[model samples]
Target chain A: MWGHVMSDEKKPVRKKLKAASEASRFMANYYHELDAASQKGQPKIAWCTSVGPAEILRALGFLVYFPETHAAMLGATRMSTELIPEANALGYSPDICSYLTADIGAFLRGVTPLSRIYKGIEAIPKPDVLVFNTNQCRDVQDWFAWYGKKFDAPVLGIYTHRNVGKITEAHVASIAKQMQELIEPLEKVSGRSFDLDRLKRVVALSRACSELWRNVLETASAKPSPLTFFDGTTLMGPAVVGRGTREAVDVYKILLAELNDRIKDKEGAIEDERFRIYWDGMPVWGRLRAHSDLFSGLKASVLASTYCNSWIFSALDENDPFNSMARAYTELFIVRSDDEKETYIKKMLELFKVDGVIYHDAKTCPNNTNCRYGMPQRLEQQTGLPSLTINADLNDMRMISDEQTQTNVEAFIEQLEENQT
Target chain B: MKSKPCYAGVDVGASRTKVAILDTSKNLIGHAVKKSGTDFTATADACLILALKMAGKKKSDIKNTVSTGYGRKNVSFARDTKTEIGCHAKGCFLYFPFATTIIDIGGQDNKVIKLDRSGKRTGFKMNRKCAAGTGAFLEEMAMRLDVSLEEMNGLASQSKNMIKLGSFCTVFSATEVLENIRQGKNLPDIVKGVYYSMIKRVLEMDALTEKVVMTGGVVAHNAFMVKMTEEMIGRKILVPDYPQLTGAIGAALYAMQNKP
Candidate 1:
C-alpha cells in the first residue's frame, strides 16, 4: 500500500538467475547435514561467526553453524521485529544489534523460521563449542558468549586488531596464534585428533570457493551488469555458510558460468540499466524485495556493495592455512580504517562504473553504516558522484518510513539525471 | 484572441496543497494554497481550479503540469512528478541565483539543501523519521501551550527572557512546556523557548552555508523564527517574497522547461 505509483507496464522485470535453484539446494543440504549432526551427536557441533575460522571447525569433524545466518533468516521472514522485543524484555537494549536480540529471543520463545522451511527441525542446532572473531564487530563476541553460557559450551575467541589500515605480519601473527590455540580445545570437544592435512584440504576448498564467488561478483562490472546487489545478497549464501566445503565451490562454479552466459548474451539483471549505484552498508533484510523492485522500476542497477564484497578472501592460501585465514579475516572492509575503507570503496565505484552511491544509515548497524562519519561527503568530493543517505535499520522495520525513502531515492535519481545532462 | 499556453505546478504537501501557474515567459501569473485534506487528488484539483481562476485563464491554457511534495504522485493531472528537494532547490535558485543553502521547514519534514553558484546541488539532508524541527513541532507546542499557532509568533516576539528547552523530541518538549507552566513561568517566555528549540533542532541538522535562504509554510507565517535564526547564526537570512509558493513555482518552472 505504501509504494510508488509506477504502473506495472512501466516497471522493468528482474531477470532471475538460473543457478539460484542449485544454490538453494546446496544451502538446504548444508543445513540439513547440520541438523542431522545435531540430532546424532556423533559429529560435534560448533557455532562459528560468519567470517570466523570455519575451515578449522570443519576439518576437526565439527558441524559448524552460523547464528548470524539464522538471524538474517529471522529478519527476512519479518519475525525479527516481533521477536526482538523478547530480548528487550530481558534487558537487552533496543539499540543493540537486532540480529542478536531476535535470535536470542527466538531461542527463548522456542520458535524458529527454520522449522517451517526445514522439515523436522524444531530449533537451531545446539553447539558443543562456540567460536568468534572480533573482526566483524565486538558485538559478535557478546552474542556468542551468551550462547556459550546458556549451552555450557566452551567459548573460543580470536581477538583481532580493529581499524586496521594495512595487514601487517604482526597483526597476522597475533590472530594466527589465537587461531592455533583453538585446535586443542576444538579437538577435545570433538573427541578427535587435529589433522593438518584435513585443515589444508578444507582451506584449499575455501580458497577455490571464494575465488569463484569473487568472479560471480566481478561479473557485475560488465556493462548492464549481469547481477545486482539484491541478487548478490541471496546468492552469497553458499559463500557464507557453505565455505570450506566442495559443495560451496561447486555451487559458485555453476553460478559464475550462468552469469558469464548472461553477460555474453548482453543480458542485464533489470530490463533497462539507466543508472548504476553503489550501496555502502548492510541490506534491509525485510525490505530487500521491495527495494529491489524499487530500483528496478527506476531502471537503476545497484551493482556493488560493501556487504556482498566482504566475503572475497583472495588472500587465502592452503599452504599456510593458519596465517592465511588470519590474514584473510583481518583484511575485511569492516575491520579497516576509514582511510582504507575509502580507498576500497573508491576502487569499487570505478571498477563498477557507478553513477551514484547510496549510503544506508542503518540504525542498529553502526559498524556497517559508513555515512555517520562524513564518508558520503568525502567520497562525493573525491569522485564527483552524488550520494544519498537513507536512515533505516537492517532488521528493524519501525525505523523505516517507506514514503520518506521513496522520496529520497527519487530525488537522488533526479540528481543523477541532472548531472548526466 | 487565442490564449498563450501556460505551465502549471501543483505541490500536494502533507499539510497543504498549492498550485502555481506561470506564463510562457516564466512569470508567476497565479497561485493558490489550500489545506490538503483526506483526499490529496481532490485538494490538488481544487487548488488548481482556484489558481486558474486567479490567473483569468481556463484549464485548457495549461500546456504542461508537474507535481511535487509528499503527495506529488497522487495528483492525477500532473504530466510528471519531481521530488520536493529538487523543486525547492530549483525554486530557491531562481530567486537567489547564487551559492546558497536552503533550509525548508515543512509540515512534517525539514530539509537542508546546498547548491553551488552554477545551481548544481552539492548535497542535501532531511530530518530522519522525526517531527522535532518542522511546522508539526510548532503546532504541537502551540496546542500544549493552549494558544493559537498564529498567536505564538507574536508571543515569542514579546518575550523578555526565553527559556531554552533541553529535549529535542516534540513529545518531550511538550511535557517540558507543561512543567514550566506549572512552575509559574511567563507565557511569552515559554513560547519563545519553544521557538528557540525549533531553531536549535534545525541548525543541528546541518551546517549552513555563507548565504542561507529559509523557506516553506513555517517561514512564511513565523517571521519571528527567521529573526531568532538570524540572531543565533549572527547573519542575515534571505527569504523569498512568497515563501510557501516556491516549491510549486519550481515545479511550474520544471513543467515549462520540459514542455513538449
Candidate 2:
C-alpha cells in the first residue's frame, strides 16, 4: 500500500482550503435562516443583488437572499440549462445574463436547487420586497426590477454613477443620501424601525470580514500560491451572503489562518505551480471545473483575479460607514476607465507575481466584457505580461465550446512555459 | 540508420478537419482539408490517412502528433492538444517572422492573436456569442443569395457598387439579403457587402498590429477577402501559401518540437 502511494505512483489530490467546509456550513445556515423566515412569520425576507447594502437589511431584522448567489448555485448544479429555456419561452433572449434567465426561469418553474439541497424548503424564501444598487451592471437594475414587478413589491434602488476620474465627495454624499432615503421604503415593507446603532454594528462586522477575506486572497501572493481563483470563487460566497454578520467574519478568520498555514507548509493549489496567471471578468460558472483542470493540468495555477477581488473593501472607512460604503461601492474596478483599469491590473500583477492574464469575455455582461478587447493589448504594452481572452458565458451552458476554450488555455500555458526558458 | 522523422499536426475545426505532415527539416510534405461532419474522431483519422498518403509516408514514419482547434480533443490518436491561438501564432510567425497580428476567421468562430517579433504570442481575442465574422455567416449569406461559396469571391470582385448589410446577425443578415434581392440590388454588390461585413466584424475584435496575417478556410476560398481587408486597413495583409493548413502546420511544429 505504501509502495502504491509513492509520489509518482499515485495521482496528486488537489488540496482545497480547509476552511471551505466551515464556510459551506455557514452559507447553508445563512440560507436555512432565509428559507425559514416565512415559516417563523416574524422577520420578513428580502431579495437583493450580491453587491446590495445587505448590512442594512441584516440590521433591520430581515433575512436577505442574494438571487445571484442562488443563480450561481443553479449554474454549478447543472440545473441552469433546464431553467434557461423557460426564460427563453417567456421572451428573454439567450443573450441576456444567464443568472437572470436561470433565476426567472426557476421562479417561473416554481423550483430551486436549494429546495432540493435542503429538504423541506419549497423554494428560496420569497421576498417581501427587493433592493439593489446600480454599481455593477444594467442587469442588476433590470433583474431586481423584474422581481419587484412580479411580486408587486416596492423596489429601492441605490444608483451609482460610472466614475470617470477619482471618486468625489459629492458622489459619496449623493449615494449616502440614497442610503438614508432607503430606510423609509424598507421600514414600510418590514414593519420595523431602522436602528442606526444596529447598522453601525453590522457595518463594523462587514469591515472586519472584508479585511479577513482580503488577507485570505493576498495569501496567493506567495510563490506556489496556496489558492486558485477557483477556490476564491467558492470561498467568496460567505463574503457576499454573510456580509455584515459576525459569523462571516469568523469564517474568514478561519480561512485566513488555513491559508497562512498552507503558505508556511509551502503548499500550493496546483502541485507544480510552474506559472501564475490572473483572471479578469466573471467566471464561466458552468465550466469552472473544466477551466480549473485545464490550467492545473499544465502546472499553471490561476492565483488571483479581478472577479474575486471585487468583494474586498480596501477603501471602506468604518468610522463613517454610509459615506465610505458609497465610495467603496462606486469605485469598483469594472466601471473604471481602461487606463485606470490597467493601473489596477499592474498593481495586481506585481502583488501576485503572475506570469500572464486570462481575460474572460462573458457574453451577457457588455458593461464588463466589452472593454476587454482593448485591455489585453494595453496591459501587454504597459507591463510586458501576455494575456489571452476566451469567450464564454457566466451561466449559459449552451454558448461554451470546451474544445475551443481548452485549446486557447492550453496554448496560453504553453507560451508561459516557453517564456520560462 | 533511422529514416528522417516526420511530425504531424491535426486541426479539428468545427466545420472542417485539416491535417499537415512535415519532415524533420520543417518542410511541409503533405496536407488535407475535409468537412468535420458529426464524428470528429473519424474525420480526423481520415484526414491523417489522406495526408500521409499524399506525403508518400507510412504511419511508422511519424514520430509525434499534436492536435488543435475546436475539435482538438476528439482526435483520439494525437499525443497532445494545443490551442488554435498558439498554433495560429506559430504558423503565422513562421511565415512573417516579426511582430504580427493573426486574424483567423474559421467556419464557426473568428480569432485575433497578437505576437511579438520573436513569435511569442502576447495576447489574443475571439469573437463572442456571435456568428457575424465567421465562415458560417458567409455560408448562410451564400445560400440566401443562391450562389455557391466558391463563386462569392469572383462575384464580389465584379461589383461596381457594394451594398451594405445593416444587420450583423446571420439570421437577420439572411433576411436583409432577401430584402435586398427583392429591392433589386445587384447580386455582385450584395455579395461584396457580405465580404465587407465579414471584414468589419473580425477587425472589431481587436486593434491590429503593423503586420497582420490572415488565415483560415474562408480566406483560402475567397481571395477577394484579402483585397477587401487590405483596402479597409489601408495596408497589405499577409497570407500563408496554404491558409487552411496553418493551424495544422502549427500543431506539426509543436509535434516536431515536443516529440516523445
Candidate 3:
C-alpha cells in the first residue's frame, strides 16, 4: 500500500493482474462451498501442504485446503500479526515458520479471513482428513498433524526423500509405491473408493495448469517486464491451492493471455523500467507494498523470483503421472544442491536480464534462509550481478525496520546505477 | 573580484551533522561538523551557514547541494539525496584511486563497501540493525566505564596489559565492563578491551580487501582504534584527511558533477 497507487477509475481498470482478483473470487467461492459441503453434497474437505499431491485428493472427491495459502492471505490482508500471538500463547516458538504459527493462531481464534472480509464462511471448514509431503519444508508434517488432532481428523503423511543428486527412476518408483500405499488410508477417511482413471485426468489438468503458469511468468522476460514478482505472488494462489481443477487451469489461461497481450502492447510493471532485479526467498508478507514501491519508485522492477517459480511443474509427465510427479516434486530448487542452485540462479538472471538481486532473509524460516549468506557473493563472482540481503520476517512485522531496509535498498540501487555509468 | 558559484554537501549523521563546501576546481574550501541536536533541519542549516562563512561566501553563492547519511532527507536545502554508501565510495576513491574496501564505523552503524579498480562499487554492507560495531556502543561503553569520551583514545593507547572484552554485544559488553571494573581491573586496560571489541565486530561485517580504507566519526575521534584495526588485520589501513567529512565531501562532489 506504501508504493503502489491503484487505478482511480470508477470502472475496474486493470493496472495489475486481473487474474489475481479472479483467483480471490474463486477462493471465496471455494471456501463458501467448503462451508456447505455436507448440505450441498459437495466433496469432503482435506487439509494438505501446498506441494502435496492435491490432484490425488481431488480425485478422491475432497476439496483441497492449504493452510499455508490461508496463512499467506492473512499475511497479505495484514491480519497475521493479530493472530500470530495467539499461537505464541499456545507455546509455539516465535522463531518457527510464521505460516504454521499464524494458521494455528487463526484456528485457535475460531475465525478466518473468509468470514471477516469475503463474507464466505464463519470459520475455516474443519478437515475430514489431512495429508502432507515434506518436499519443501519440515514444518508441514507437524502443522498438519496438530490440525488433525485438533479437528479429530485422520492424518496421512507421504515421506519424500531429499534429492541430493540427480533424481533416479528408483527414487520415483519408491515415491510412487508410497503414493499407491497412501490411497487405502485416504479412502478410509473420506469413505470413497480411489479411482486411478479420475486421478489420471486430474493429474493431466494439473500439468496443463502448471505449464500455463510457467508461460505466464515467462512473459515478464519481455523488455520492460509486463509484471513484477509481487503480482506473481498474488496470482500464485490458485496454482498452489487449486492446482488440479479446471478452474485453476482457466485462471492461468486468462492470466497467460493477458500477460501476452500486455507484452504485445509493450506495457510494463513500472513506468520507466531502469533496472531489473532477481528476488530471492519469500516476500516480506506484511511489507510487500513497501518493498514493491521502494523498487518501483527507483524504476527497478523485480522481474523474477525463486519463490513464485517454486510451483512451476515443468518436469511433470502426464503419461507417467505418479513417477513423474515424484521426480517433479522432489527436484524443486529449494531442495537442490549448491551447484544446481547456482545454475538455476544464473539461468533466471540471464532470462530476465536483471541488473542485480535482492534477498529477503525471512527470520522465521530456516529453509528459506539456506545458501543466502554465501549465495550472493558466489552469484556475483559467477555472473557479475550484484546482490543484497535484508533481514526480516515473512509474517511478523515486528522483526522489520522499514527505514533501515529502505536505506539499504536505496544504497544498493545507487550502486547499480553507478555500475551502469 | 568576481563572485563565483560553489557546491555544498550535507551529511546528517545520527550522532553529528557535517557540511563541506567545494569551489569550482573541486577543492575542499570549508567544512564544519556539529552535534546533531533534536531538530535535524535546524542543525543542518546551522552547519551549512558555518561552512559558508568559513569559505567566505553567502548562502546564495551555492550553485548546487546534495545530501547523505541516515538523516539525508532532513536537510531541507539539499536538491537531491545520495546514499552514504555511494558518497563514501566516491570520497575514498578520490583519495585512493584504486580498488578499495572501506570500513566506515559511524554513530549507529558500520559499513563495509568494496570498490573495483575503476571506482565503481562492487559490493557493500551496512550494519544498522545492531549497535555492536558502532560509535553508539563506544559511547555506551565509555558511559558504563565512568570515563569521558575524549579520554578513551589516549587511555587505550597507554594500555600495558590490554584486556579483551568477552562479549561483542553492547549490552553484554557493558555488563562485562562493569564486572571488570568491580574486580579492580586497570582503567586503560578496560578501555583497550573496548577498542578491541569494536574493531573485531567491524572486521566481521565483511572481508577486508587489500586496500582497506577506514572512515567515519568513530575513526575521526579515535586514532588508536584505527591503529588497533591495522594491528588486528596485520596490514596498513588508509584514512582520509578528515575521516568524519568524507561522506559530506562525496555529496559535494556529486553536486559539482550534476551542475547544469
Alpha-carbon lDDT, every model: 0.90, 0.84, 0.85
| TM-score winner between candidates 1 and 3 | 1
Backbone clashes counted, model 2: 1
* All candidates: DockQ: 0.43, 0.27, 0.38
Best by TM-score: 1
Judging by DockQ, tell me the better candidate of 1 and 3: 1
Interface RMSD of each: 6.6, 8.9, 9.1
- Best model number under lDDT: 1
Q: Which candidate wins on DockQ?
A: 1
Candidate 2 lDDT score at position A256: 88
lDDT (tens digit, per residue) of candidate 3 on A1-421: 1111222322111257676778778777777777798346457888888888887899899988888888887887888888889989988889898988888998888767777766646777778888898876888898998988887888887787763567778877888888777898889877899988888888888989889889988998999788899888888888898788899898888888888888998988777788898898888888878778888887888889999899988767767778878878878887777777778888999998999998878888867764454878888898888889888888987778787898899999999888898
Instruction: Write candidate 2's Cα lDDT for A1-421 as tens digits.
Output: 1101112222233577679999989988887887788678658988777878887788788888898899998888888988999988988888888888998999999989887777677777877988888777777778888888987877888887774467779988998899888888898888999988888888888888888988999999998899999999899999989888889999998888888888999999889888899998888878888778778877888989998988887666667878887777777886676667778888999999999988888877776673444767777878888887777788887877776677667767877876677
TM-score of 3: 0.95
> Each model's TM-score, in the order given?
0.97, 0.90, 0.95
Clash tally, candidates in order: 0, 1, 0
Write the residue-wise lDDT of candidate 2 on B111-175 in tens digits.
88888888877667777768997999999899888899999999999999998887768888888
Taking all chains together, the TM-score of candidate 1 against the true structure is 0.97
Q: Which ten residues in a row have the lowest lDDT in candidate 2 chain A?
A: A1-10
What does candidate 1's lDDT look like per residue over A127-207, in tens digits? 999999878788899999999999999999989798999789999999999999999988899999999999999999999
- lDDT by residue for model 1 over B2-70, one digit each (tens)? 998899989998988999999988788999999999899889889988999999888889888989999
| Candidate that beats the other on lDDT, 1 or 2, i.e. the better one | 1
